[model samples]
Target: MVVFFDSLQGVLVILVMIVIGYILARSRWFSPSSSQIIARIVTQIALPMYMIDTITKDFTKQQLAQLLPNLKYPVISMMILFGLSVAIARLLHVRKNRRGLFQSMFFNSNTVFVGLPINMALFGPSSLPYVLVYYMANTTFFWTLGTYLIQRDGEGTWKFDIFTTLKKVFSPPLFGFMIGVVLVLLDVKIPTFIASDLHYMGALTIPLSMIFIGIAIEKAGLRNIKLSRYSLGVLAGRFILAPILMSLLLWRADVPQLMKQVFILQSAMPVMTNAPVVAKLYGADADYAAIMVTESTILSLIAVPILMTLLQK
Candidate 1:
């Protein structure tokens, strides 16, 4: 009962933040262009700083080393989920314009925006290391295969470019993770002032991200977000199929209970908030991607609580 209330509180807080954003956007206090700027800030600066601060402050070399062996679980699970997503997209006959969006939604969750806070709320700060482990796998897949899928679907072609894919895979957030790990492993002492500054800047990630989602929802227009065959199918895969698959994958794995719960909750998270940004940048169906992000997030208010509650049982 306590776990249920905690999970419910966490979900409600997120929903309230998102609602605040929506109201601001709807009232014209925040323009659509403002969302673009916020996205850049979140992705380029806030997110990376958050990664560095969280990892450096909370994790140690030995703890990281311990996490290394268990890292394979998230990576393998993500890979399998991505493959299954592709198959499902094809089976659903999701239109070409939205095909990549569909597949990306399935695998790349809003790990940072929604996943981080919920994990902390439910499992406490000690779960940061495990959360980062999942982040590594999520980032790896998003930049490489995730990018490739969106690009291909957007372009309506299968032209492969190894160099391009490699470039995308080593994104700024990934660099932040790598640098944090290196610092810990090398036992490099970051000055107190610098660490404090990073934390201050990093603190913007969650609010900014939630606001961005709200702006996206306003732009997508709530009334327009109907349950089309495509949207319904994507939602089913995201909220229903993905969680079950992740649970089965981790059922027999020998990991901490918290880690398994975190992983499963993350798997059940809404589609990545950045999905539309990536879709737009890569010439995929930006409209469809935005709708998916917004709809999944709104629906997650209900879905995530129920999912977490059941997991506790």
Candidate 2:
């Protein structure tokens, strides 16, 4: 019971930030364009800084080596989940218009925005490296295969572009992570003043991220979210099967307890917040994607506390 309450306390911290964003958005403080701005700042500026700061300061070479091998756990889990999502989509006869988005959402996750904070809340700062390991896999897959499927849902055909795929895959956050890793491997030292700057800038990542999510939910309009076979399918994929698959993969593996917990928690995160944007860009069902983003994010609040309780046990 104490563990459950402690876990709930962590979730409550997240809920409060979300609510602030929701309220401020309702007041029209955040324009529709604001989600884009906040996302850019977080992903491009704040998140990268966070990575550089954490990696250069907090992580050790030994920890980095161990973290790299464990990347297989998330990558393999996502691949299996992708296959299963395809099966479920077929079984349900999901419409071609939104089917690609459905499967994409099922297999991918909001690793940075929702997953990061929740893990931080539940497990504290130590969970950051494990969360980043999962993020690397999630981001690469999303930019390549994930976006391709989203494009498939559009009116036009999607031709594969290696350069474009590579650009997106090696995104700013990932690049920041890469730079940090290199710095660590070379055993280089960051100047004290610059390190302080990185710390201040990186601090914006979480609160702003939560606020962006709230604004996104507000923009999507909660009333528009309803469970269809498609939404339910996505729900099952995210909240149920994803974690189970991750757990199975990690079951016999020798790894740190924190890594296992972060992996499982990340596996159950909501649909990638980028889903609707990519859908809109591709001329697919952006509204459907937006609704699922809202729906799954809302449900994850409920799901996290429950899962955390079980994990605490």
Candidate 3:
């Protein structure tokens, strides 16, 4: 009981920042380009620095080794979710235009934007390597299979660009992580000045990420949201199904408790923020994707605290 409230308090701390962004976006304080600007700064700039700072500082070679294998858990979990997404899509009789997009959004999560900040707030920097591991698995799958499926929805044929897929997979943050890992393996240490700069720049990740979510919500329009079988099905996949499946997969695994907790929490995050962009780019229903993002992101505030309490027990 107390645990739940404590978790709620942590989420509320995050909510305050999100509310600030929501207000700013609503009041026209944030321009149309604000979300894109913030996202680029967070992903291309802030997140990579954060990855380097945490990975280089907090993780040792042995610890990184232990963490790498755990990636398989999230990969396996997502694969199961992917299969279930197909089954649920057919069961729901989702439209052909939106069916592939539906399955993509159902299985992929907002791992970096939502997952990182919440994990840091709940578990601190020590949870980072585990978080990165999950991010690696989640990002790879989302870019490759997830994006391909979404593209298929738009094109209605087997269409995949390996060059584009590879570019997405080996993203800036992953490059940062790889650099950190290489330095660790090579026994190289960053100079004090450079490390300090990275730390300062990395500090922007959390608050900016939360604000991005807020902007996304505003862009999606709260009035536009409506409950339907499709939304309900996605809600089930994210809030209920994903976490439960993660728990089952991790139940008997030999790993750190924090790893288990972080994995479970991350598994159930909102639909990917990139969903709408991909849907729109590929000529699918961007509005539907946007609604799913808004719906899942809003519900995750409630879901996170509840999931936290369960993780505590």
Candidate 4:
């Protein structure tokens, strides 16, 4: 009973923070423009600092060995699930543009900004190693596989500016990851003062991410988009079914118990914010992608708690 309550309490705290952001946005206390400004700060600065801080601490070869296998596992599973989603969309006779948008948004997730917070809350600092490992893998997949998928049905071909694509792959988070590897390899020690400073900056990830999410929600109004039973089911599949399928696969592959939990937790995160941006770039259904991002994020607040209880057990 106590265990269940504690878990519920932890989940509720995250929800409350999300709610606070939502209220602030809905109440017009923070204008949409202001939210975008803050989001830029959080995404570019705080998020990278958090990644650097989290990746630099206590990372070792042994930990790497334990973590790396599960790293690729979740992402590979995600690709498979996303492919299935596209196939499902086709079978439903969805329009090509809408299908493209659905595929992009359904597969992509807000891994850095939103996922880090949810995983950190559920697992703690001990989850850092796995988080970094997963980040490394997910980043690679995002650049290569995700980009290709986004471009496949749209303007840019997979062969378009491969070098530029690779450059994007090595963006801030991956840069932090590389620094972490150097530290691990050189056995360099960071002073507690510097570490503590980084930690302070890192702590902004959740609140700022929630605010960004709230702004997104406001931009993609609840009433502007229409939701149907089938669309709701796809959202459910993305949030619930995908995680369950991945969990079973991870278990079969003998991933570490804790790592499996993280993978499943990550899989359960809502559609990525970048999806809309990518869709817009490709001249795909950017608005639809945006709607998916907003809807899935709002839905995941409920879905994730249920996911936690199911996957953590």
Candidate 5:
């Protein structure tokens, strides 16, 4: 019961942020262009800083060394999840333009925006190291293969450019992750003033992301959100299939109890808020992505708590 309420509280906090964004949008204080600008700020500045701050603050040389060996769990788990998502998307005969969106919805999650805060809330600061491990895997694949899936589906082309693909894989967020890891490994300390500045910037990631999502929802029109078979499938993939699969994969893993719980909880997160942003940038079905993100986020209020309760048992 406690687990359920904690999960519910965390989700409600995020939903409230979204509601605030919606109200602002309707009042003309926030526009579509403002949403885009916020998204840019998040992706380019806020997210990277958050990544660096969180990773450095939470991890140490001995801790990271301990985590290095277990890195295989998340990496392998993500690969399997991506493969399953691709297979399911094809089985559903998801259209070409939306296939990328489908795959991303099924596999990647709102790890930065939703997963981080919720993990902290549910499991406390102790969960940060495990969260960072999962973040490393999630961020890497989302930017690499995940980007490819979305881009190919959006463009309906198979033209593979090695240089372009490589470029996309090493994104700004990933760069931050690498830098943070290097600093940790070298036992280097960031200047206290600089770290404080980065932390302040990092704090903007969650509210800004949720607000951006609310702007997307406002643009999509709440009344217009009809749950198509495709949308239903995405919901199942994100909320149902994902948790089940992750549980089965992690059930036998030799890890701490909290680590397993964090992995499962993260797998059950709502669709990535950035799905629409990525779709729009890559010429995919941005509207479809927006709808999935909005619907899944709303549904997560119920889904996350239930999953948390069951997983706790």
Candidate 6:
């Protein structure tokens, strides 16, 4: 219990950074548009750099062989949990109009935006391969499998173009993933000067993303909106219940300690921000998606730290 509390201290520092961003956003020191630019920069530029740097520096055949036996545990664990979360959202009786948004909420997480930094900070360079694997697992699943469930039976009166959705898989960050893999495969050597510059740029991704999250929350007016029990229920499922249940199952399955921690931590993360984007595109409840992302994000400060403390022990 004492160790748990001490580990919670690390989580608190991260929460404080988010709170500072929120305060700045509410004060109008930064506009939502600018905050979005920060997110875009991070997502399009900084995050990809981080991914490239991590992957290019570390991947090797021997490491792959060692991780082969355990790789399925974390990746499959996430797929199952994502599935269960969506099933619960469907079961909750959210109105038909809102169901797609709610389902997307459960279908995705803020892993790339938030999870990367936390993993890097807490576990250091040692967890880079797991991070890469997690990225591949989550993004592949989201663009392909996750999209089908969201658009398959919707009332949008629109054609569900799997091709267009598949195009999203080649997003800038993902393209970076491909480039990173190529560099690793060819054993491309980055010079000291260029590598150092990219590393410096990559460092800004998480903090900038957090600021964007704050600005998004302020613009969305989550605090002023009336909370439905249903919304709260969804948030509870994402932030509170899901991680605990999933972590236990993975632990019992004898997954590696680092991968177990990564899975649990990612599960504890807030609902994905781009969920609203997907909702709007698919003619779902964009407003509800915005609300879920905001509320879950705020609550995750409490939820993640508590869950981290519990699991780390």
Task: Name the candidate, 1 or 6, with the larger TM-score value.
Answer: 1
Better of 1 and 2 by TM-score: 2
User: Backbone clash tally for model 6?
Assistant: 0
The estimated TM-scores of all candidates read: 0.90, 0.98, 0.97, 0.87, 0.87, 0.85
lDDT of 4 by residue, 1-313 (tens): 4545655666676777777777777888876478668767776667677766776675575776566556567667777877787777777776665665565555556677677777777788667666666666666666666666666657645576778877777776667666766676677878999888878987887788877777677777888667865466468667866787777778777656777777777777777787777777877667777787878877776776677666645
Query: Which has the higher lDDT value, candidate number 1 or candidate number 2?
Result: 2
Give the higher-TM-score candidate: 3 or 6.
3
Stretches of model 4 off by over 4 angstroms after superposition: 1-4, 27-36, 151-159
Candidate lDDT values, in order: 0.81, 0.91, 0.91, 0.70, 0.78, 0.69
> RMSD in angstroms, candidate 1?
2.2
Per-residue lDDT of model 6, residues 199-226, tens digit only: 8887787788767776777777865556
Model 3 reaches what TM-score against the true structure? 0.97
lDDT assessment of candidate 4: 0.70
Q: Estimate, for each residue in 197-310, the C-alpha lDDT of model 3 and write its tens digit.
A: 999999999999999998999889999999999999998999999999999999999899999999999999999999998888888889999999999998999999999998
How many clashes (backbone N, Cα, C below 3 Å) per candidate?
A: 0, 0, 0, 3, 0, 0
Q: Estimate, for each residue in 25-131, the C-alpha lDDT of model 1 and write its tens digit.
A: 98999754898898889878987888888888888888778886777877777778778877888888888777877887887887777787667766776787777
- Check candidate 3 and list the clashing pairs: none
Candidate 3: worst 10 consecutive residues by lDDT? 152-161
Give residue 47's lDDT in candidate 5 (0 to 100). 74
So what's the TM-score on candidate 1? 0.90
* Model 6: residues with Cα > 4 Å off, grouped in runs: 58-61, 64-71, 78-87, 145-155, 225-227, 252-255
Model 4 earns a TM-score of: 0.87
